[model samples]
Target chain A: MTAADHAGWEVVIGLEVHAQLATTSKIFSGASTAYGAEPNTQACLVDLGYPGVLPVLNREVVQMATLFGLAVNASVARRSVFARKNYFYPDLPKGYQISQLELPIVEHGEMLISDADGNDKRIGITRAHLEEDAGKSIHEGLDDSSGIDLNRAGTPLLEIVSEPDLRSAKEAVAYLRKIHTIVRYLGISDGNMQEGSFRCDANVSVRPRGQQELGTRAEIKNLNSFRFIEKAINYEVERQIDLLQDGGTVVQETRLYDSDKDQTRSMRSKEEANDYRYFPDPDLLPVEISDEYVEAARATLPELPEAKLQRFVAEHGLKKDDAVILTASRALADYFEAVAGAVDATAQVAANWVIGDLSAVLNRDGKDIGDSNISPAALAGLVNRIHDNTISGKIAKQIFEAMWDGEGSADEIIEAKGLKQITDSSAIEAVIDKVIADYPEQVAEYRAGKDKLIGFFVGKVMQETKGQANPGQVNQILKAKL
Target chain B: MSLDKVKVQHIAMLARLKLADEEYASSVEKLSRIVDFVDQLSQADTSDVRPMAHPLDAAQRLRPDAVTETVERDRYQQNAAAVSDGLYLVPKVIE
Candidate 1:
């Protein structure tokens, strides 16, 4: 809910995001961690929790987690233990899910998010711990029984828990987006919400504005998209507020958001609220990370979003807003840098064309920057034509459309279409002379101090030359002649 | 430490065990005695000692990130009592 809807109450929200680590195999087994496969094909004996099988930690998982911790400036625990959280579910072939309880890998991490007020706010990360994901249960297409697919069992996940610091659904989304950007920048996770690689569960509560204690919190789970996360948290906040105002107390339980109905309904809570007796796993010893390991991971950390944004502004001389937009994705930022670096024009021109026109076409075609039809070099070529006045900026749009349609380079398009700007002083002066003769009334109005009619004369000159005349030269000539 | 019949019944339910009504009394007695026996260790004053999870004083060994397992779904499913399309079927647990 919006902060204004709180109605003399304070909204306390914390988010727990589970990101699937980009690993080649399961955390404790050698089984493949590929997303789609035949049912139960990827699950190994250790993944299935077979008897007498012991788990060995994956080095890459720990290294990836360490990289994330370093990226967020969190402390990498010298030693962390894996524990068993006992529960019973059909998908869990093992009676317990191995998770971290007291000692997690990373803690006290914070990230800056532009709050609802669009100011820098640092949200504290309570902890990020390593855990194994559970298998999937397919209830559909079965007449009376649910089928279990263990293919996703024992996948490595880093569950990041945030402090109860959020005040609005919008702020919560900002925090989530910041985390997504960080993980993708770190290259530890793909951050693909569609494949359940990154998912969020929001713990939302509200209390009187001046109250020190928190209200009973309801945990909303399985929100995959940013839109659903915002809507679900807002819906939950409104529900809790309405309940408390009606003299009903809020209950602490897990909720699933019904996107179709745009409402949240309580799932069975008794079994979930039952005690999960956590005990350290006896089979595996405590994991101990070395300072050398952390240092090595730190060295591999590429320039993160903040550093990239600053570099784009300082080195490329782009505006802060454009830098932020380009730095949202690593590939997009790289694309911008490539264009900016290769163009004969100012980087700001590259930024404008990339952010304004190129992004519009990409969004309309439902294509990612990676799948763009126009390569960065080709785009730079197009920008170069406008920069050197080989083509007017207006004609550049036409050249860009041709380039997107695979009509060769800008020079080739200009040659084939005869779309060169009329930069020769004689040619432009001739067009301006013709336009002045054609639009005498506008010329008279312009000389009579209707200076805005200069646009009318300029348009006529552009029409006479088929939009090839240099706009600045035409403006100067028209103003002097009038 | 003591475990009552209700507590034992709750534990049975948590573990998904079907306990007969008469079995609760014996389970509580045995469980309480076991807890009491373990509780005797609490009498020692070792608050300064670090909690140990495993007996071995070794760190967890890490395996390299590599997929060595191949498709053994046919051999694995042979142990299942019922399966359709390589999935383990269980009674529907509708909420």
Candidate 2:
């Protein structure tokens, strides 16, 4: 084994991401693969291992996996074999998890990741394989053994393995975000991190920056949020770095992230390859997918997020940063384009409102655009109101908040709240004239070369108008008046 | 295959399994066979093959940022073997 301190340390990050495929049925059995079902109620005989029960592949799951492979430009293995990943667990009724091992269904794709510096890098895709999720073990009951919720048992999961090419926590987060975007764009996984539809295990270790030897890595499991991921990896990295600095050796183990302490604690010393005791699952036959099936799934592929982002930047004249922020979520992108198309305004402006005001309100309310009371048409209407000077940007923010709270249309909110922009030159001129009259000393200071105090006069005028006045008109009118 | 017996035993120990001595011989055989199968995978002309990450082509989905509900801590801790002030108790080391 190569020692971690032999050279400069390189942080090699490979993510084992488990995505719950958005299929209506379980992968192997015909049980309803719905979330939030009562415990054990959804477990069918096939899933529960009754005698002579045969495992059948869900066509929808295979199609969804194939669609993902196509979207990422991965090789869909025409033939893939299912194998039993053997381990004893109370939650896994089937003695072993029915997962693809020797022959994964999807192989060798590249995920394009963009950094905060506007640089796009291609991360190597290792393989994506189909598997059935283990039932959740609820250790919250009076029984000595945990209560098993088999609702998640046999639920379809696609395990995406990535190459250990990432060097830092930020890169890992960017890669995760890119993966998130691709999966949502393909419409295969809902990517709900909190509900456990999408989860990640980050393999983190610190070596010298150019070291060939990998450090004894710890696997941080079941991190669902991007914030947690970045925080977890960063904390783990520092912990590892501190250990090395203190002359302590890092152990190979599986660790859990304590959200409270913001530290990683070892669950167990990590299992090696031999511990799984994997073998071909004889109960299921080798999946023989034909060219036609692959073709059909490929044909249904939508414009993936990467391609759409590129189009937005190149065709619609949006900035790369703007395209990225807009295309972070498909619904957000769709809302933006609908509004952008409706208002015929700058894409940057639409992008700004979506990422800034819209996202801020959604974040505050703990909602996405899909759950937000703001519809695309209403949002488009609001944007139009801003574009036409009917409501200033300042008033439009208020209108948006009202719209989000299920209030009336943008026009109605403006009327009811008396929020129309004070664009009338005479009215704005009068307000500016009064402000000039009231703050004559400030006006004299502005004329006496304190140019920065002009903002003070503009603030007073906007305050006098109850923030309904157009800022540009206020600035323009104030400049002429001053 | 017999030479892999020690490696199998180490792996079993790492996984916290209490295998009988008799089971070790069979586990070595089984693990050897499986390792051989995995060895064959490296030769399947995958020089051009990419390792698969996720089984699907779609981006990872996200739920609305809203907190669904809060877990009642007292109810959640009711099943613990030992609890003190809403915390699970494990055996402490040292004074």
Estimate the Cα RMSD of every predicted model relative to the unseen true structure: 1.8, 8.6
* Residue A197 lDDT (model 2): 93
Residue range A1-482, candidate 1, lDDT tens digits:
56566778888999999999999999999999999898999988888878999888999989988988888889999899999999888888989999999899999898888886679998999999999999999998999999999999999999999999898899999999989999998888999999999999999998988999899999998999999999998898899998998899998898999999988889887654459989999988999988888888888999999999999999999889999999999989999989999999899999999998899898998999999889999999899988888998889998888887789998999999999988898888887888788878887888888988878888888888999999999888888878
Please state the Cα-based DockQ of model 2 relative to the true two-chain complex: 0.05
lDDT of 1 at A155: 95
Q: Which ten residues in a row have the lowest lDDT in candidate 2 chain A?
A: A139-148
Q: Candidate 2, which segments miss by more than 4 Å at Cα?
A: A1-7, A115-118, A239-250, A269-273, A421-482, B1-95
Q: DockQ score of candidate 1? A: 0.88
Off by over 4 Å in 1: A1-5, A437-450, A480-482
The C-alpha lDDT values of all candidates are 0.90, 0.79
Task: List, for all models, the DockQ compared with the true complex.
Answer: 0.88, 0.05
Q: Give the C-alpha interface root-mean-square deviation per candidate.
A: 0.8, 13.2
lDDT of 2 by residue, A49-163 (tens): 5578877777777778899899888999987878888775656766788898878999999887766576778889999999999876555433343455566788889999998
Candidate 2 per-residue C-alpha lDDT over B32-85 given as tens digits, one digit per residue, 9 for 90 to 100: 888887787767787776655335532222222122222344554465466543
Chain B TM-scores, listed for every candidate in order, come to: 0.92, 0.76
